[model samples]
Target: MPLTVHQFPCLEDNYGFLARDEATGLAACIDTPEAGAILKALDTLGWKLDLILNTHWHPDHAGGNAEIKAATGATIVGPAEVTRISALDREVKGGDVVMLGETRFEVIETGGHTLGHIAYFDAADAIAFVGDTLFALGCGRLFEGTAEQMWTSLQRLAALPDETTVYCAHEYTASNARFALSVDDDPALKARADHIFALRERGEPTVPTSIGLEKATNPFLRAPRLAERVGVAGEPDYKAFGAVRAAKDVFKG
Candidate 1:
């Protein structure tokens, strides 16, 4: 059979997930901010999680690890840097592969949100679990790494197949798009933002965005040229990218 991915909302719009392989009954979680909610989602889907994938060390992304790990005995897999932040069974690097049932995940070192942020890529399924690196219409704030690192990270993600499904950790589409609208009133972005705002108004999720869709509208993903323009006297690395990102940081819709 194929893989079944279930995305459940938890902890103030944060997302927790269970990706299962029907053929082998192997399932895993990308992140679990709340064990109770994640466990419930698994039960609802009749899944037995065998693995835990942590994208980074943010509390909202890994806060439920101990509880879920205790309950399911799932092997914890995370960025190579996790060894410094959390107890882990394995330390993974870019190009490393993680298996869950029938699905094979390719790890992507997409830092910037955190120095060790890693995005899980299931190429065959066109699915990506990018913790907080890239959102639907914007990118994560530079928490640890510089803007250059984040620019490179987003570029790596953008290089994935256009059909890839982006499963980021938060429901930030509406807000991100609001910022996008302020930058340039691109009709497409405004329209997309309106759709997401309505979803928020009625309590809905805006996620699993396609890479192609994001390429068309996300302001952060489209900042290479703008970055070049904004670099402070062209500082070569951080300043160049920082200029563009800083603008987005201040954009108000």
Candidate 2:
């Protein structure tokens, strides 16, 4: 069965919470930004949260853990390195699968925005909680990890089925779209940008983009696609991955 996922806004400029399955009484909150937001969301949906999944140890993402746990008694599951930082109830790494009720999720390590950052994928639902690693039309900034590392992380994600719906942590599509336009001349992106612009203008979200959509319009996802789109002279080196990374770093939009 395809598990249904819901997103709830949290914190300020960049936080989101996800809820899956209400009838099973099974729900997972991805990146608990504030205890109140999570609590309110659960209350609004009449849902009981059974697990709290953290993508990284960033305070904005995990700050509500202790309080939420106290209130809901939900187990906090996250990357092993986040244990000290997030005080996780369950420490897991790559290749681990989490079974919550009738749904299953696989963990994919995406060490870029943070060295220990990871993304959870529900093969059954074709949905992903990518956190800061992969954003719409762009990739996460190299913080604790290198440009190469971020590039590698995106590749792992890009390799997923084209239909996978990406659920990133932030609403950075407008800015990312601007940068994507600067890096690649795709009429498709221009159309997407206009559509996204209107969506934002109307106070709508431009996320939950399909992997195929990102594969076609996102710049970071276009490294290999660029080679196919345009020769662009001397761009076929093995480091073409890094080439796109470097371009995005310098892109001024």
Candidate 3:
């Protein structure tokens, strides 16, 4: 059976996710944006929090760790660097696999949003919980790692099965779609962008975008395709990606 995923909005624009393995009644929180919201969701589902899986050391991502762990006595599993910002019961890295009942999540080190950042992918479920690494039509700002690192990281995600559902951490899709439109005017991209606007305008969530959809529309993932628009047509992968990120950094739209 597929894991049951419950998504809820948390602080400001952040989102919290709860993935449960129905067979074993085991549940895990992908990140802790707010303790109150997460605890409330658990209460609603009558699911005890067995694990708290963190993606990075960012405050918004790990801020509720202490509170949630205390509330439910959930074991926290995250990267080693997370210790600098929050408590962790187990330190995982790339090539490691964490079990969620019968479902297994493979950890991939995607250090671009933050050095040592990681994302979880479950092949059996065809889903990924990417904290701040990749988003719909956008990618995270380079807060710690370099463009080269980010490019490599994004490629890792893009290479996943096209049908994989990507659960990102924020509601930045509308803004990202606008920026993507400014750079790439492909008809397919326009169609997706229009859909994103409609979804957000309706106060609906635009997350859980597929890897195939991102491959077709996300500017960060399509650096080569956006190279000309970003003014680095012949640049290397890193340079092209860097230009796109730079443009996105100051883009008013």
The most accurate candidate by lDDT is 3
Compared with the true structure, what per-residue lDDT tens digits does model 1 show for residues 73-111? 999999766665468888898889998877889999899
Least accurate 10 contiguous residues by lDDT in model 1: 225-234
TM-score of each: 0.92, 0.91, 0.98
lDDT of 2 by residue, 53-170 (tens): 9998888788888988899899999997676566877887779998777788899999988999999999877888899888888777777887667777888898999989888888
Model 2 lDDT vs. the true structure? 0.80
Candidate 2, RMSD to the unseen true structure: 2.5
Which portions of model 2 show Cα errors greater than 4 Å? 224-238, 250-252
**Which sequence of candidate numbers ranks them by lDDT, best first?**
3, 1, 2
lDDT of each: 0.83, 0.80, 0.93
**Residues 71-186 of candidate 3: C-alpha lDDT, one tens digit per residue:** 99999999988898897999999899999888899999999899999999999889999999999889999999999999999999999999999999999999998898888888
